[model samples]
Every structure is written in C-alpha cells, then in structure tokens.
Target chain A: MLPGGSTSVTTSMYSDGMSTSDRLIESTRELLWERGYVGTSPKAILERAGAGQGSMYHHFKGKPDLALAAIRRTAEELRASAEGALGGPGTPYERIEAYLRRERDVLRGCPIGRLTMDPDVVASDELRAPVDETIDWIRERIAGIVEEGKEQGQFAATLDGEEIAATVLATVQGGYVLARASGSPAAFDTGVRGLLSLLAPHSS
Target chain B: MLPGGSTSVTTSMYSDGMSTSDRLIESTRELLWERGYVGTSPKAILERAGAGQGSMYHHFKGKPDLALAAIRRTAEELRASAEGALGGPGTPYERIEAYLRRERDVLRGCPIGRLTMDPDVVASDELRAPVDETIDWIRERIAGIVEEGKEQGQFAATLDGEEIAATVLATVQGGYVLARASGSPAAFDTGVRGLLSLLAPHSS
Candidate 1:
C-alpha cells in the first residue's frame, strides 16, 4: 500500500484529477460570472481555485489571458448545450420549441448577455470574438433548421428563415433583460410564449 | 447695461440657458453609456459638464444622487422618444412598426441595457427604479396600443396583447445586445424585420 500521508497529500493536491490549468480556468470562469472583469481581482481567483499565486501566474500571464480562456470555454459549453437541443430527430418547430423550453435560471441572465453589457469584455477583441462567434453560430444553426423546414414544407413558403432565427435569439436574450429589470420571471416567460405562438402555426 | 466684467461672467454661466443640474445629468448620461457606473468617476462627470467642484457639490450631495438624477433624465428621454413612436394615430401594427423602425445607432447599445449590466447600478434602488419604470412604461404603452388594435379588429382574434408587447420590447433590447456583440447592425435589422413580418398579417 502507498504511504498514507503521501496518498492523502496527493488527493488534496489533485482532487477530481483536474489539472492545474483546468482548475485555474474553472476558478476564473466562476469569478468572471460573479464579479465581472473589472470587479474580479487576481487574488480572488487564486483564493477560489485553492491554488498558489505562482501556479496561477504560471498558467496565465494576466487577467486578460485568463479571461480569454474562460470566454472560450463558456462559448464552447453554450454551443454544445444548444446543439443538444437543436440536433435531435424532430421537426424544426419541435427543435425550436425544445430549445426555448430548456431550463434556465432567468434571474441570473444569459452568460453571453452578461458579457455584452461588460465594457471591459466588449473593449477587447480577444474577449469579444468568442462571444460574437458563439452567437453567430447559434443564429446560423437555428436559421439552417428553419431553412430546412421551409424546404420540407414544415413552415410557410413566405417565412424568412434568417430573420426568424434572429428573432428567436433576440427574444430569449431580450427576455432575460426584461426579467432582470422587473425582478420577475414572468416577463421572460411571456416573451418566450409569444415567440412560441408565432412559431406554432408553422409547426407540422 | 450692467458692469462689463461681472455681466460678462454671469452671462457666460447662463449663456446656454441650461442649468448646472441639466449639464450634470447630460454629462452623466453620456458617461454612463460609455464607461458604465463603476468606471465613471464623479470627476469625469464634472469635467464633462464644465462644472467646477464647488458647483457640482453644491448642486448634488454626491455621486449616487447625481447618478439618480441622470437616470431619471434618461428615463424621461427614453419615454419621450418611445411615445413619439407609440402615441401616434395609426394601426397598432403601424405604430409598432414605426417604433421598431425609429432610427437608432444600434451598435452603441441601449442606455437601460447598459445600466442593467452594471453591478453597481443593479445594486442601488435609486439607480434601478427609473430603469425599471422606463422599460415597464414602454411595454405598457405598447400593450395599450395593441389592446386598442384588438378593439379595432386590427389584430387576430386570438392574439395576446400583453405577450406581444413584451415580445416587441424584448426584441428591440435584445437586438441592440446582439448587434453590439457582432459589431454589425444586421442583427438588429433582422430582428425588427421578423417582428414586422409577424405583425403584417394582423394589419389586414
């Protein structure tokens, strides 16, 4: 058997088998979500990660570098989550409905929407590119499905796929703003339901 | 007629006929658009408004008070602008279309959306209340028009006026976020067009 003290130390040092970089990234993501770019301090990140200062500095040159990693990770997770809703074997209307109905903490706002409001996040191309790309991907993905539905006669012949896709995305993001502003989830639900009703007649 | 130097100095101060408070609010509104709440300093507001420290302090107690005044001014301006679009004598569909088509510098983002993203703004009731009221007023104003449309047989029999009103407001706000994120006005146009198309059938 391994030495008890060494094994315990090993477990403490590398719990969950997350590498040093992953731990740093995870911590940065949480901090970014909580305090935003301007409010989060490096000391806070290190404290949350349970990592030493050297390890963090070694992994990332500075806050900007750490933020880039976090933004990319968030983008990827958003895309994957969306794909899970949009890629199933169903009519385009079904897919759209499923995506809209996906559970969300409306009060917290969309992670991507939060970034749009951030001056620091919007000022840097390094931070904004992932956000732009992720949203573009989502809109394109939805538009493609809508286009497919149009070709298959699942939607009205006059439906504008690209425009509808933009509307769908806008409704959800805008819904979050309304919910946050009113301090209630009802506004968000109302917006989503309105969008769904708009799509209902087109569903086969 | 008055003493030359003293008259000149007093005239210079009142030349524009704008009050110091007005100047301060205008300056804070622009700064809030650019720097958000945390990034904007009291000094920045004073300098931008060309008001001296003594004048600023004499007019307002402190930053929060100044910000509250600025926020209220912004709310009033926003309501006035929206009323220009929503209060006109037209079909509900026409009024909404006019509101949506109201020329906007879409990439700059909405003033209220910018405030919602600000942690400091969200934390203070004095700051948040005007934002809440302004958005609520816009939605209610639009909903009132929609209800009128229903009475006039301009909307489909089954349409939900409140839901559609929320959707319309959310779309515009979300469109701003999307456009700002992508650095393009295309998303905003697409969202507006899609909503207009949705409303078209009801117009007849």
Candidate 2:
C-alpha cells in the first residue's frame, strides 16, 4: 500500500463484509502498482486479496479481465484526483502548479505511466487503450487551461497551448522516473520547481 | 535493433567472430532493453545470443552478474552518445537542443529509464547502481551547461542551473513514457518543442 494510505479503509475493505469482487479488484490494483503485469499472476492476486481460486474465477474470466477492471479504475482515480485541483478556482498556471505540487508517491511512480513500460500492457491494444485515453484526456485538459491562460494574456500569445501542456505532462511523468531511479523524492521536487520557475519567471 | 544501426556490425557480433563473453553481454543488454530484468532469463539470453548454456555459465555467474556488465556498458554508451552533442561546437542552449533533437528509437523508450519501472531492478541495488549513476551524470553534465549558459547571459541570472537541468532530464525521460503510452512519437516531439520554445522564445 502507498505511504499514508488509509489503513482503516484497507482493513474494512478486506473484511468479510466486503464483496469478493471488490476485494479482488482492490488487490489487483495494489499488486499491479507494485508489480507489472508480467510479474503478477492469478495465484498472487488471489493470495493478496485473500480470495480463493473459485472466488476469483467467479468474479472474472481470468487475469487479463481482472487487470482491465483494475487499470480502468486506476485511470478513473487519476482523472478524479487531477480534476480536484484542475477544476478549482485559480489561474491556469496556478492550477497546473497545484496539480504538479499535489502529494504523490514519488518513488512508486504513476500507475498509468508505469504501464507503458510493461511489455504485456503495451502489446495489447485492449490493455493499452485506457492508458492511452487517460494520457490524452489529461493532456487535453491541461491544454484547455493553457488556452485560457493565453486568452487572458497570462501567457505570451505565441505560446502553443497543446505543446506547453504536453511539456507539463512530460515533466511530471519524467519526474517519477527521476525520483524512482535515484530513490529520492528530491529529484521530483527539483523538476517541479524548475518548471514552475520557467512558467512564471519574474514572479519566482 | 535501432533504426540505422549497422546491420553488418550486428551480423558480425552474432557470428562466430564474436567471443562468448561479448555475445553474452550484448545479448543481455538487448534483452534487458526489450523484456527488463524480471522478464529476462539466462536461457532466453543464451538463445538470443546463440551461445551455449556452458558458455553463459562460464562467462558470468548468473543472470544478475551478466546484467551488471550489460548495464555498465549501456551507461557508458549513453554517456558517450550524449557527450557527442553536448560537447559539440555550439552555445549551451544549442547543444541542449541538439541533444534533445538527436534521433532516437522513440517507441522503444530509454533502456536506462525503463529499468526504473522494473520491480526486480529497483529492489536490487546492485542492478540499480548503473542506472542511478548514469542519470546523475547526465543531470550534472546538463547543469554544467546550464551554468555556462547563465554565465554567458543566455539565460536569466536568477535561474537555477541544477534545477533546470533536472527539468530538462525529466522532460526527456517523461517524453519517452508519453510516447510509448500513446504509441506515437508525436507526443515526444511536442514536448521537445514546447520546452525549447520556453527556453528561447525569440528563436521559436
């Protein structure tokens, strides 16, 4: 589980009261984050979730089917979390800054971004679709904010909204790699600070 | 193999001309890039390199031992490649631009960066050392250049070189993730362009 994740919620989730299906998905999501698809197996999923083989088969067809549900849920959660700051009242740059500064498991990496490195996930169109769509949606949402910034003259008229948005996304996704590779959140913070300074030079 | 990689050189490397140790290292490097540590096995490496099991065992203790050699070689190669452009005849910004615009196998992603996502790679400090050192070296090199740029008044005096260098590295490493996720090099290109524009607004 992620650092600071609610232990109470986790305990409640795995209790007998929770449905087997929900337990299976929650476990899959956690396992998938820690281990890529190739490293994860049905037995491991069942073991982590405390579900029996029969219960797993009853809930989903197989590993791939269960993985899809987990991936989709993760993607949805990412979108919701980003939207919490993105949709809040602020200038475009401020909103972007908020999104970048939001608390993250720096060493753990972005769940959706990590999938790109997973051979199984990249090989399957069905598996890759949600990952692709999630990235596209995030880019588009940031682009929309950038466009608004340009309209308000907060950014130079010549700046390309979509392109800048893409850069912001890249900085973030890349920051996780930097953090994880070095085993330090300092790497992530450095990138974020540098980008913010670039975006709002005189202010900083 | 990468686009434009010397076919004859590759054939020669795989042929009887290449020594068993060389073949083992080369094969390990290729497999590590494609399958990562968890997905790669000694059996698969031997088969790919066309070496016998005895030869692999003779050359290295095990998969982990072989991976260290491959990773060190890769780190050296990455440094040499970056130095080619970074140390070339141009301004600091120009050198950075050249480095960013260098031809890459976009869909394949960064071999070093990819390892950061591998659970086995992250868990083993022995395996992760080269990756960590390589990234640190690259960032330091970039910071040196950014410092030179600031000294030359090419960038704002208030800019932080190390921080900006980290951001540059993140944009690149993250760009690879974005490109792989979307199955398009366009994402990568957009990021590069966006960052370049930010660096030199007048030029763009």
lDDT of 2: 0.86
Runs of candidate 1 exceeding 4 Å displacement: A1-20, A51-55, A202-204, B1-19, B52-57, B202-204
Instruction: List clashing residue pairs in candidate 2.
Output: none
lDDT of each: 0.80, 0.86
True contacts kept of each: 0.58, 0.76
Worst 10 residues of 2 chain A by lDDT: A3-12
Give the best candidate by DockQ.
2
Quote the positional error of residue A105 for candidate 2 in Å.
0.6
Tens-digit lDDT string for candidate 2 (B88-130) = 9899899999989898998888989999988888888999999
**Residue-level lDDT tens digits of model 1 in A102-157:** 88888667777678767778778888899999999999999999899888887766
Listed per model, the TM-scores of chain A against the true chain A are 0.87, 0.92
The best candidate in terms of TM-score: 2
Backbone clash count, each prediction separately = 0, 0
lDDT of 1 by residue, B104-130 (tens): 878778887667767677767778899
Off by over 4 Å in 2: A1-13, A201-204, B1-13, B201-204
